[model samples]
Target: MALNARLEIRQGQGLVVTPQLQQAIKLLQLSNVELEAFVEAELERNPLLQRDDPEPAETAEAPEAPAASSDELEFSDTSTAKADEAMDAEGDDRFADDPCAGGPPLTDWSRAGSGKATDLDDDAYDRALRRELTLSEHLTLQASQAGFTAAEAGIAQVLIDGLDEGGYLRLDFDETAERLGCSPELIETVLLKCQGFEPCGVFARSVGECLAIQLKDRNRLDPAMQALIDNLELLARRDLSALKRVCGVDDEDLRDMIAELKALTPRPGAAFGGEPAQTVIPDVHVRADPLGGWRVELNSDTLPRLLVDRRYHAQVQAGSRSDADKVFVADCLSQAAWLVKSLDQRAKTILKVASEIVRQQDAFLAFGVEFLRPLNLKTVADAIGMHESTVSRVTSNKYISTPRGVFELKFFFTAAIASADGGAAHSAEAVRHRIKQMVEGEGRDGDVLSDDRIVELLKEAGIDIARRTVAKYREALRIPSSVERKRMLKAG
Candidate 1:
């Protein structure tokens, strides 16, 4: 082999993902809330960017509506002239020398990716003021009044911080003592005192310890109760005879102890302040059209309306005295324009993907879950002339509100189960739903359907599913085994 350096002029196709293009591709996967936050951050960072909330007078004066979209289900006010102008951002000689003027890598919904932008992650929204004191806060207050020395109070704080989300202290005594440079005996003494704090089970190392602390606080942790706690595994398995022998109690006494155990709190931390629950907003709305098919529309409220303030850009550009200042203004304008264009493209892509989904699952939307045909990303991507990756990104974190119900976009793409008759394949989601219906409908006839029986029933309905697959689906649905159900029914 000869080692040589040669410049061979080989020209071929290649994908070059620029900084701006990368952000646009990322936008496709972001949920509505995330997209809103991303746009808001961009607006704040780029001085040339502004919200697209048109003034009332401007709206009235510009009543000569932009062309309506061919699909009734497209994004509302999508083709506003102002938005288009913002995207252009003085497309003149200034951008001729620009490095990032070329557009994005994904399929163009419009003339997007025509400029460059960067990405940012920021706090999108403010959570409402919640409950006053958190778990740590409450514990700190309790520790201050517990009459502990300063060193012991410090240890208590460390113990409080060490608690898991379920209020269990997962730290080992040896580890805590080593880290704090304290004696294991002192650590144990402090732990015993902290365990006596309010919300009795906060510093326990295990479920049994948590229950024991609660029982001890209630003055019910007798020797028999301690024995019962020691053998909680037998209680969980419902081996009442073994538990009675271990606790040395009669059946009635055992039942009473078990009932008392059930009354204690397992997770003391969960009752304290935590992150507020965030509400999911659907990105697409699907409803029946008056004349015929489904009409799909974007959730306009969640969509961020962005615009590039070219006038502000021009003002800043004119005021620039140095080369650095001019370059900064130009870059800001480019970034702002790219963000607006990316958002517009994002909305269009979401609408297109969502519309195709509605069309494919028409039967499902019209009827119910049983009618949902087996669908895949490739099917929708091929139908819409997009890549499978693009479809996947569009579906990620995206949701649709249909007349039937609100569902995530990815919910429509279920694995296919082979059909018994060699006809159309069955959707795994549909099969799971059928199983649930079958389970709920049973016991009315004084019978419980076992996994094997469910598989047979499904096969009779033209679905060729295995027994183990049926069992897996049953377990996923949290449905207990047939034997357990039979015992439960008898007890009922």
Candidate 2:
């Protein structure tokens, strides 16, 4: 019974994630941008690793790049079978060719990730082709030509510096006056001059001020219109009667004023250059197959074409300069080979997971959002013969372009809401979409759907969701409560 030590032999299976295994695991979860950075770092660290980019002549000879699309998996079944067969062999066996290598499939597609739809907007193409002058640059140039007295010009520079990205002068005149060692009256005078520079509403201190400036430019800043701008909050609340009373205008005139107000820019500086919007490089592209089903493939432009330089390895090996040098060379060879294999494996795993998701959500792709089936990571994991955790990693930060639009892989794996009739469960996303449709299509006569009422509608549609669940979904959608909505829809 007492603790005792004895020589014994025992064996048990355990997961020991080696450095190589860790690399594969890390590669699975990284988004395209992160993966590229990781590959670039590895290239720098390992001399034997090289980028197998396409030659310029080969690229030029290639046909014009197709629109953002899904290939029918040029990585053939036979090639995959061959890869699987050789995977267990030594890493040295497959250094000759990169299994993931191909044409720059995304060529023009990566730079323009908004997809082919952007092509329809010639303005978008034009904007992309030209480097724009920023709000700061445009204002500074105008100030130089704006022709002000020395003191007024100095005050204008201070005012311009205080302007926000919306081109609104957010500076407190008194605080700015103190900072610039000038009188607040002089600051106001300079600001008035700066306001007339360009874009019409440049030096506005408030939304009402911004709009009033624009109206002044168009010779429409009548007293009633000015009153309407001042009471924009009432207009936003849809209190048409209140707006008409406050502005001293009839219903017809108020409606016209509101329409004119809508046409003015709320954010005048947003049109000018700011920090560029980041474009998502999708990991997978799903497109309609000519014959029938959905075609899914990896966005190969995102996949780094990597190869192990066996020639370099052989050259390094033949020298046999020292034991340390031999070890370093051998280690580099191992690392380079493992990286190539890991990348190939990562690509295959992504395609497998994506294809299974497309299969499960086939109804959604063919029809619309309402047809999206209840899905979870476990469902995809089991179908693809992988673990739930593995599927989660594959979906992390990964995006897919479908016929509908570019959606994150995680978007397809919505929680399930039980069915009222005990039929197939409904996807939470689909239910949320349904709730949104109901709210948006509500009659202008002022009938707003309450949470309880929404619950009833969902149940009628075969969703067994509770009133609390309905409220939660509504809140998540940012739809106001029935009381709030009724007030919003109040006419008088």
TM-scores for all candidates: the values are: 0.53, 0.51
Cα lDDT, model 2, residue 130: 82
Candidate 1 lDDT over 1-492, as tens digits, reads 999998889887433334554465667677787777777677767777777656532321111221122274333322223322433454422111111223333233233332333545523322313445767668878875564443465567668767776788977888666555568888898899889888879899999999999998889999999999999999989999999998999999999999998888889888878553356688888878889888877887877776666666667889999886876676776666666666666777778888888888887666554355678998987787655666787898787887744667876765778998888997665677688889988779989999989988988999999999988878766689999999999999
Candidate 2 local lDDT, 1-492, one digit each (tens): 799889999997432223334345556777787778677777777787877756532221122222232343322221233332344343432221223323222122223322332122233334534867778668877765554433454456557656777888866777655544557787786787788878888889889999999999999999999889888889889999998998999989987998999999987877887544347678888888899998887787888777777776788799979776776676666556666666776777788778889999898677654455678987886676565556777898798887755667876765688999999997666677688789988765558888888889889999999988888777766688988888877754
| TM-score for predicted model 1 compared with the true structure | 0.53
Report RMSD for candidate 1. 17.9
Q: Determine which window of 10 residues in candidate 1 has minimal summed lDDT.
A: 59-68
Report how far residue 47 has shifted in candidate 2, in Å.
1.2
For each candidate in the order shown, give its overall lDDT on alpha carbons: 0.70, 0.69
Q: What is the lDDT of residue 19 in candidate 2?
A: 36
Model 2 accuracy (lDDT, Cα): 0.69
User: Given candidate 2, what's the lDDT at residue 20?
Assistant: 39
- Please give the distance, in angstroms, between residue 302's alpha carbon in candidate 2 and its true position after superposition: 1.6
